[model samples]
Target: MTRAKVLLIGLIVLALGGVGYLGFEALGVRGFSAGIAAQSLLVLIVVVWTGSYLFRVVTGQMTYMNQRRRYREVYDAKEREDLEARFDALPEEEQQALLQRLGLDGDDVRADS
Candidate 1:
């Protein structure tokens, strides 16, 4: 695995272990009834955080797309049109290849046209 991915997984494991330990300590010191509640709360918080992190991971591409759109929005209309025009000036095959790399090319958008 990649170093970054290995690091991330290691951190996640450590976080889970720390939380579990804390929950167990709270249960032992607080007595059965209160400990159950504390543990429940801890588990709930971890679940929510993990779920949020997973959601962000799953939507990472969409997040990038939103950022790109926002970046384009920062340009004035004339500048945006000029940028588009420059892009359009590229040869059709190159344009299609670029779009394909971005996973955005469709069959209808022929490279030969």
Candidate 2:
């Protein structure tokens, strides 16, 4: 329901109207008696309009999902940083015990030495 989505929907409606008018004109439908050609054109317009609307809906959902994922990533990173800082502030014995419990012994890896 954003302004851009509204504008796009309006544009699509206008395009469908224009195409329907042209179809009617091309079919030479002068009077109230519409033929199969006009009906087929109407169907085509409906199909195209529906497709455009669905596309907008799908893209909007995807954008929302992506935004949510990014926000979660940022939030999780902040939380992790806070947790790491708290862990680092603990005594060495407590830190070592916690790391061992988590299967991350400090003495298990030594690349600089």
Model 2 CA deviation exceeding 4 Å by range: 2-15, 18-61, 107-113
Could you tell me the lDDT of residue 24 within candidate 1?
A: 70
Candidate 2 lDDT by residue in tens digits, 1-113 = 69999899779766766666667767786534344555567678778978986886877755677789899999999998898788779999998898788888776523322
- Predicted structure 1: clash tally: 0
CA lDDT of every candidate: 0.71, 0.73
**Total clashes, candidate 2?**
0
- Model 2: residue 74 alpha-carbon error in angstroms: 1.5
Error of 1 at 72 (Å): 3.9
TM, every model:
0.34, 0.53
Q: What is the C-alpha RMSD of each candidate to the true structure, in Å?
A: 11.5, 5.3
Q: Which ten residues in a row have the lowest lDDT in candidate 1?
A: 104-113
**lDDT (10s digit) by residue, model 1, range 16-91:** 6566666777657555645565566667977897899788878774566788877878766669679668768999
